[model samples]
Target chain A: MHSFFGKQLPVAVAFFSGVLMIITFFSGDQTVADFSQEQLVWVTIVGGFSLLLGVASITRVSLSDVRKRRKGWPYKAVLLIFLVASSLGAIIEGTERGTLYDWLFQNMNAPMMSTMFSLLAFYIASAAYRAFRARTVEATILLITATIVMLGRVPLGELIYGKLPEITDWIMNYPNLSVQRGIIIGAALGAASMSLRIILGIERTYLGRQ
Target chain B: MNHDIVLFLEMTLAGFLTLCIFSFLYKDNPFYRLAEHIFAGLSAGYYVGLIWHSVIMQQLWVPITQNGQYSLILPGLLGVLMFTRLVDRLSFLSRVSIAFVVGNTAGISIIQQLHGFVLPQLGDTMSRFGQEFWGPLIILIGVVSTLIYFYFSKEHKGALGITAKVGTVFIMVSFGAHFGYTVMGRVSLLIGRVQFLFVDWVHSFNKIIN
Candidate 1:
């Protein structure tokens, strides 16, 4: 009963819902399509509910740390406070065109996020200078391809060598695509295996117990 | 002068950011710390705003308002359940949310992966040999051999050993390609900033033209 209700229930619903959605994609039946849409909505609802766990967990941990007065607990508290306040504000006051939520979003959020994203430039540069080294045969091929692609992508490539585009495209379309596909397929199979294990109750680590 | 003022401002900010980045080379200092924190705050604010507008508003509010309250009940309930993590004793209630999210996301991702990742990738791989008969054949051999070399189930020796060695060549090329592309991207960004400083703000070219 515990397995059925506690663990299996959600998985069962998801599996069935997934099948239904797939069917709806292929089917012409309006009623069936409608049913699938509703099921998807239910799926979304379930997803949203699940996301709350993250927020709640964060809040719980941060609050606990705040109460205990642990080192660097203040940052956690600030984050928790920000999360809760923003969530609440958005939920209650949010509207389509403009709202206080929109103001908070534009004024407070966009600039900060863009600033953080900008850091990638500096980090990538430093890492490149420090870590980039060709130690083998494979590195040479990569170096050649990278140089060609870089030259080919912009107007500068044409200025440097008119044939760069043709060569770059050939490389990208042929070997690069093949290698990328192989990696992607391997990755998908791994993910599917992992998901299957979870659904079948073979994997229980997420249950938060050994 | 108006343009120069804006140019000066941009150059100043760019210079400051560059310095903050450089400071990391020496040691973690107050300047780097301040810049990092400010960036952190700004980015967090941006993300929070984005979530409010994009996810919360579009997914929740719009549906409830347009479709009517009854239609949104299930999703609303599920979303509320996400907050269950806040309660220490009842925190396990958050699992319901997790189950819903993980199940549906996995389900959706699997289907999307088949269409988006698998089909196109497969098509590309299959078409490669046709485009460059010998080139792709050699690359394919190299890729497969390298993968076999990495495989640990059995020993690679004799003729198989040579194939594995050749495979290493392909792998090195791939990494080199990746590195070169990354460097090119960073260089472009730096160039973009320089262009902005020179053309957009300073109007140095205007003086030359006059």
Candidate 2:
């Protein structure tokens, strides 16, 4: 029963959906397309529920910590309070504009997230300084190209050299496009093959072992 | 006066959160951790709000009640089933929902990756051949060489080794450009936060005094 539910059942479902998608894609039948479209929407709806699992887990962990009076328990308490506040606020008031949820998001979540991300600006430049030492030919090329691209992006590069922007554009259009395309093709092929494996029930990793 | 006070309070909270995050630059402290916890909890809560409004209400509830789209109920049931993972005996049933999502995603992505991405990119690369000779030539070399570098079936020796070397140079340049762009993005976000602090937050003080 365990094996069936855990592995065989999941794989069988994967196979069915995978085959259905492939058929719908190539069939050129309107009915098939409509059916797949419905299936896709259903999948997205299911995707939404996946986040609830995270909520349950975070709540469980934080509750346990608070119960235990762990170190930094005050922070966990704050987190729980805010979590309940935002989720309940949204549930009661709805998520439309001018709601408490929106206000919380606009004031608290947005600025905090942006500031956290912006901190990486300080760290990444410092990191590049420490890491990009031009130790070899590849390193040297990377350093020079990075410097040129960075400079070209800012107003200072154009002020320093009139042609810097053009050189940056040329590099981006040619070399960057080529390498990115190569990477994309390679990744696409990999993903396709992986999808095939999953559809065939050859890839069982998604089903956690009992 | 009340509305102005509310606005002022909001501005002050946002600025405080912004400063809390930036305090990480000096070192991790109580304020940073408080902001970090708020970020985690608020993001999760925001997602809950979004899913409730966007997915449950819009996708399922309205569609069923208003449009008589009874088909949506199946996905709603499947989504609800995801909560059963909390109970050990019924936990296995959650895999059924997971299977549906995973299968559908894998099935769709195969074609999306191949037809949507690979075919278009390959066509674009080939189509560029009729343009100015050197630019296209350089791109072609970069693509082919980069692909060869990724290929690991055969040992890199002699001619293959040399080609792979050229591939590395292109890859490095592309990587550098990517790095430069990422830094620029982070810096721009940092500038926005700084602008908010100076132009918005500090300006509010003047309003209060006036």
* Highest-scoring model, DockQ: 2
Q: Per-residue lDDT tens digits of candidate 2, residues B92-130?
A: 888888888888989989999999999998887778777
What is the Cα-based lDDT of residue A31 in candidate 1? 99
Candidate 2: which stretches are off by over 4 Å?
none
Checking candidate 2 for backbone clashes, the offending pairs are none
Model 1 lDDT per residue over A22-76, tens place: 5676789999888877767766655644544444455567678889999766565
- Model 1, residue B127: C-alpha shift (Å): 5.2
The positional error of residue B145 in candidate 2, measured at the CA in angstroms, is 0.6
Tens-digit per-residue lDDT, B1-210, candidate 1:
576554455445655554564466568876765555444433343344455565566777777788775666666666676665565555454455556555555555666667677676556556777666876675566546655656667677887777667656655555555655776666666565455446643564454345
- Give per-residue CA lDDT, model 2, range A1-210, as digits (tens): 877877778889889988899999889999989988888999999999998889888888998999999999888988888888889999899987899899999999999999989999899989987887989999888889988999998899999998889889987999998999899999999999999998898886775555
TM-score of candidate 2 to 2 decimals: 0.96
Docking class of 2: medium
